[model samples]
Target: MDIIERFLKYVSYETTSNEESETTPSSDKEIVLLKELVKEMKDLGLNAFYKGGFAYGDIKSDSNKSDTIFLMAHVDTSPDASGKDVKPRIVHFDGSPIKLNENRALDPKVFESMCYHLNHDLIVTDGTTLLGGDDKAGVAIILDTVEKILKRGNYPNIKVCFSPDEEIGRGTKGIDLEYIKKDTDKIYAYTVDGGEIMGFSYENFNAASAKVIAEGVSIHPSIGKNKLINAMEVIAEFHDHLPKCRPENTEGREGFIHLVGMKGLVERAEYVYILRSFEKDELESFKNAFLESKNIINKKYNKDLITVEIRDSYKNMKEVIDKHPYTVDIVHEVYKEMNIPCVDWPIRGGTDGATLSHMGLPCPNLGTGGDNFHGVYEYLDIDEMKTMVQIITKIMDKLE
Candidate 1:
């Protein structure tokens, strides 16, 4: 199938991952797309399998090429918005807002990036759901590139993986690194799961998550004075103690503590926070700040009212990619040769590559021509998607 056809088919699966589930995929629906991708790979004459909610496949090089490249893209969409019954539409841009329905429209004025896509065909949603182009576009590009290379009969060995629960930061958690190493001799890898056409990322935030529990003594209102403590008030106080210039107020290289989830009653309350920073020391500082707030809350209550536990999620990939600069240089050279401008920017959020790189993969990230990922404004520039396919093919050619 062509890139557009493949992309549209993949998005029709409604593979939105759940962060609250305990299964390997976090949602059974993800397996639907995983199985289809495995079948597609096999039909194309490549070795493929669906294992543990992940789709894995490989195509051998027809030529005597020793270097193996691994391409990865997640099959799951973010749960932040509805992914069910997504109605995608194709529209030609004329430098104006594209109306999805009477109630909603994709405004270039709000999303200035749309200006760059003028005169290009775009795949968009109906404004009620996300388009899932973030990584589905990546999936189509990898599949299309592999098909083209195989038809031509000369290329480096290529391995493809479609992971699940990437939107929840667990995409690579279940992947067996030892098995991958035993299966192929990997020289380089990249996640085709970034935003924008020319934008590539090696640097991402050092991430961690924290859960805070606030305990309170609940009593009747008549006897509440000096006898009862409100957990909701304590939770609010905890939040207030956090830096005012936090995630929403900061940008570019600056890190902050973002409260993602909160639920509680008067007797008990819980808050989930994601802490991020570009530097490890800075991330540590942010953690300390939270700890200090927790300390103050405990002291104010004169009891252990607030308790917090923090866990590391992933580190910056640049720390690993820098060791193998040639991996990035190759992509840059290919982009230059294809006359595509290369934009290297720090990823404000994490990708599967971030965790995979730390696990001895030395993987970086490449763009999939997606914009406004994880929301209703998401879109894919068809022209840019085609360009990415060409870029991948050229990278493989250079490897040969």
Candidate 2:
């Protein structure tokens, strides 16, 4: 199958995941695509199964070699925006901006610095919804590469995993390593899960999630002065006390406290936050600082206006990747051989590879040349994606 065709078809499925859902996939819609992948994998003559009712797809690669290679990609789109009814646009580069509409044009002026794509064919989203290229592109590349390998034969043993609900962050929690057989002997795993064409990643954030609950006494607004404490006010006060150096004023490589979600009123209000950093100690310090802030607020308010809860989500993968340097070295060598300039970059966000690395697979992420992921502005360099497919083919050959 053509990779672009596969990508378009995959995105056509509404797999946008919800972070609030308690289910395995976080969204029932994700199953629609997961099952489709299971069907496709089986049709390609690979041993495949959909575990937990389409929460994920696991397929064993058909290769004669003893050392196994695993390729991973997520099936979930971001819940930050709508992924439903996505209408993708394909441009043939006629030397002018591809008009998405009379009001909106797929021009570099609006997308800013997109002039580089003026001469190349590209795939973009309609103005209404996200294109879902983030991992769909990754999915297409993996599936197409697998089909090619199966047709060509004589390839090393391969394992393909299509995980669900990755966009909301629980993508790899249920992964069963026992099925892979070779365990640590599985040479090197790669996640085609990064963004843009610069395409190399071996480090990711040490992450944590937090919840703050503020309780107050409800009273009439006129009598609420000294007779009652407003929980919303307490929460606002807590927010005011948080460091200014936090998310409100930081970016790239610099960690911060992000206020992700907040709700409720006078009686009680809840605040949700995510703490991120590439350094474990730094993340820890950031968490500790929040704890200290909580303590100070509780004491100062004298009414238990705040209760802070914190939990570690995932750790940075650098420690494991650094130990198995060759896991990354092999990929760099392959990229160099293919003449694609490779540069190791830090992932500001997390990937399934981050969790897998700590789970005994030193997997790093590579790009499928996707940009502006998870929003209507999302697009992919079709040529770069094709190049990525060819690169994966070469990487598999080099592994042998």
Assess every candidate by TM-score. 0.90, 0.86
lDDT of 2 by residue, 1-400 (tens): 6887899899899888888888887878787788889889888877788886332333344555556677888888888788988888888765566676556666665665465455667888777788888889999999999898889886777788888888877888677666654433556688897665566998988999989999988999887787788888788878777766566688778888889999988899999989988888888887777777778889987656788899998888999999999778878888888887877888888888988898988889989877778777777878878888888787778764
| Candidate 2, position 359, lDDT | 91
Q: Pick the candidate with the highest lDDT.
A: 1
TM-score attained by model 1: 0.90
lDDT by candidate, in order shown:
0.88, 0.80
- Candidate 2's C-alpha lDDT? 0.80
Q: What is the lDDT of residue 77 in candidate 1?
A: 95
Clashes per model (N, Cα, C within 3 A): 0, 0
* Cα distance off (Å), candidate 2, residue 17: 3.0
